[model samples]
Target: MMFEGFLFVIHLFLHTYCQLQVVAQCFINLLRWWRVNKWNADIFLNQTKNLGKIPGHVSLMFLEEDTPVEDIVKPIVWCICLGVTTISLYDYYGRLRSKKLDIDKELREYYSDFTKNCRNSPKNQPSPRIQFVSVENGRTDLVYAARDIAQDLLNGVVKEVTKVNYQNYHKVFRNDHPDLMMKFGIHTTLAGYPPWPVHLTEIISLPTCHMISPYNFLDCLNRYFKIEKRVGK
Candidate 1:
């Protein structure tokens, strides 16, 4: 009975310590966000550039299905301003994917406002290419790829399963693999993001964000560069 009581006390202490750590980290993150928010988009990009290499393709995953379309646009615009060419937005379910058009329109408006206020010349900015991905996209692509592979095997196009290469799957899902994936919530579960594409991607998670604050977005990108991706090494 005494041993079990001691174990319970230890667990309580550990849990309390963890909660305090979380609170301290949250406070630090808030301060960083405040500082980053003061800078213009161009300035933030310039400062972050010195951190390391910028990602050409970025994936933003919102754990919540009901995340507002406007909130989704903020990060997309931030990616554009940071000179990221390809941006993918994802949610667990297909809810956000269904509103792709609305998000696209909002992105245009949001980016337009950003550009107008931006100190950088319009010609210097690169237009962002946005893709909305959901679990359904992955499911469909997997099904298509499997069917193709099966047909190839039956028709002697592919002799063995071991002979199938990345190219076979790439042909079915033509989207560029993301260089960096950022999750906008504390939840660690990927919530059904396509696994194949992100095998080598650097993923960073931030606290739950209802709106894409400038600091959190920029910090996430900065963190991406600092990570050493030693995949399968």
Candidate 2:
């Protein structure tokens, strides 16, 4: 009985110590977040000059359900303002996919502010394109691509199996694979994002995205540009 009591006391102490450590880490993270100043298009424009390269196609993956549409749209607008040509907004489920019109409406509103505040004319920027990709879309794209390839083969359109490459598949979908994927979640796993497209994509995991500030967005971009991709070397 005494030995059991002593073991219980040790367990209690360890649990309390772990809880305190978690709290201390949270406090440190909060302090770091507070130190990052909010940025705008003007700041982004300046930062772009210093950046080595910008991702032409970027994907924002939201793992959490019920994420506010504004939270999703704000980053898209920022990406546009920063001159990303294409953007993909992905959620684990198809909830956001059905809300495409709503997201577009919100994007336009946010974009107007970016144009107004930015020194460079919006006309000078490449027209930004966006897609709402869900888990279903990933599966559907693969299945449909296979079906199409099979049909084309039967019709003698595709001469060789080797011809059915990623380029052809991507052309069928009319979407470019993401160059950089930003996953907004505390969870480590990607929650089963389409494997084929992101084979060579750069992925950065972030905390649960609420109102994503420009500082956080630009910080991700900075991290992406810093990576040295030694492909097949």
Best by TM-score: 2
Candidate 2, run of 10 with poorest lDDT: 166-175
Q: Write the per-residue lDDT of candidate 1 for residues 130-222, one digit (tens) a residue.
A: 777878767677887788878888999877765336345643235577888888877878887878888888889877656557767867766
The residue-by-residue lDDT of candidate 2 on 13-127, one tens digit each, is 9999999999998996676455323455676677677787778889899988788776788778777866789888787776887898888898777667656655764557768
Could you tell me how far off, in angstroms, the CA of residue 88 lies in candidate 2 after the best superposition? 1.4
Computed on alpha carbons, the lDDT of every model, listed in order, comes to 0.74, 0.75
TM-score of 1: 0.71
Q: State in Å the error of residue 212, model 1.
A: 2.4
What number of clashing residue pairs does each candidate have, in the order they appear? Answer: 0, 0
- Please give the lDDT score at residue 68 for candidate 1: 68
Residue pairs that clash (backbone atoms under 3 angstroms), model 2: none
After superposition, which runs of candidate 1 have C-alpha atoms over 4 Å from their true positions?
1-39, 121-126, 152-175
| Cα-based TM-score, every candidate | 0.71, 0.76
